[model samples]
Target: MRTIEEIKGRCFITEDGHWLWKGALRPDGRANIYAPDYTRWQGDMRTQCGTRAVWHCMHRKPVPEGYRVFGTCTEKACCNPAHVRCASEEDFGLWMRKNGNYKGKTNRILANRAIGRKRSVFTQESIAYIQTSDKTGRALARELGVSEASVSKARRGDIVVFAGAAGGMFSGLIQRGAA
Candidate 1:
């Protein structure tokens, strides 16, 4: 295992306080470190990843089981302890969702569903007919940019706000007895 002294000698601190490796870098732009004595570390097999090695060298402790170090700064090669957190991948995903870091397209759609931020693809007249129209759920969903389940829920009256447009007047169907 390379001693903390050796690792520190190969790295420099950034203006932001990150310990960046000056050695070889991986294709992903992450630091790469390898040592002949690395096998001596029972704690994560003396990681070849520069960031992980930096954490181990600084903390002088093994990473807790069921957790991996994540870069809070979004830098894969950042070795600053302050920028790293130890958490299960699942927990990290939950944190991402809560912290608005979950920007995946599907997740964005889910966020839209939760907050009613999804734009209404149906007009007032379209909403009025969603319930009585003989169109299939798939067609309605595609036309409305919603899931087939949403179309079904709207038809069942489970979604009172069936759509949003021209103000919150989506429930206009109820006033007109369109249901």
Candidate 2:
């Protein structure tokens, strides 16, 4: 395994031969350390995707062998190496499930249901009606089979505006505002 300090400083070489100074290949075969990019902030070694290695020092795990940390340069262009953990292709499926990282029904339907099962929270038509009309919280709650509190919360912008424009009613509610 590569020493933590070595992984932390090493740079990744991209296929085009450009030096991606973000991540490094650990000697342990399990890590790809991504170096922090030059940034305006001091000691900011986080990745563009909102990940950081704060956990590494906290977890104190050694970098694995034969692993290469590549710069994801995700849309955000972050260089946080802690986001670069690895898994064998054979264990990828298990990893996703265990980490609650998959887009299955558990994340879609069941999770939505847990939030109240109101179709309005997930539909544009419902949002338009709520935003474009003078529907009361009670009325919306009745229509959507959710609690009046849910309707109020949505209207107040305390939650996502899934109702879209119908969600506009939230402004009125906020203007008149009820918690």
Candidate 3:
């Protein structure tokens, strides 16, 4: 494994104290580090992110399990210990929420459902009708002003718009003859 000094040598410090990595970068632009015989379980060689290696070097220990090392600076290539911090999944979610870049899981699901509803030609009433009706796909499509493929999907529950229980919205609204 490379030493902290070797890692530092691979970066050039910016005026603002960011150590921009000059080594291999991931497709997403994060820095990558190749370490040989780094972990016993991972065999003779293992590839890791530069930030993670730097964090391990500075802290004298590996990041805790279920924790991630992230750069606090805007520069994705930076591996400066001062510019990086370790966070758990929950902590990261909280930070993302605080930064207005995240919505809670439930809220995100609800928002996505709303968006799908808006873009879809089928409504709650139509979806229930499609599921329960004995009508043919072509007939249902013509009646609902949608394509036969859509009606078929709805009948197969591929498009779920029913109310009540999990994975659905508008609870207590689906019923026989509701349409």
Best by TM-score: 3
| Tens digits of per-residue lDDT for model 3, 29-65 | 8889765322232333467777776765666555677
lDDT (0-100) at residue 64 of candidate 1? 69
TM-score-based ranking, best first?
3, 1, 2
Please list all clashing residue pairs in model 1, or write none if there are none.
Answer: 1-37, 1-38
Better of 2 and 3 by TM-score: 3
For model 1, residues 81-132, the per-residue Cα lDDT tens digits are 5676768878988878877775667756555554563454544565578888
Model 1 ranges with Cα > 4 A deviation: 35-47, 59-62, 98-179
Q: Between prediction 2 and prediction 3, which has the larger lDDT?
A: 3
Off by over 4 Å in 2: 1-121, 161-179
For candidate 1, report its TM-score: 0.48
State which candidate, 1 or 3, has the greater lDDT.
3
Error of 2 at 134 (Å): 1.3
* TM of each candidate vs. truth: 0.48, 0.24, 0.54
1-179: candidate 2 lDDT, tens digit per residue: 12334543444545543323354434432234333422322334543222224234333443344432233333222324444444444465566556665456544544544455344454545555656659888888888887888667666655543332332323435544465
lDDT of each: 0.65, 0.44, 0.72
Model 3: residues with Cα > 4 Å off, grouped in runs: 36-45, 101-179
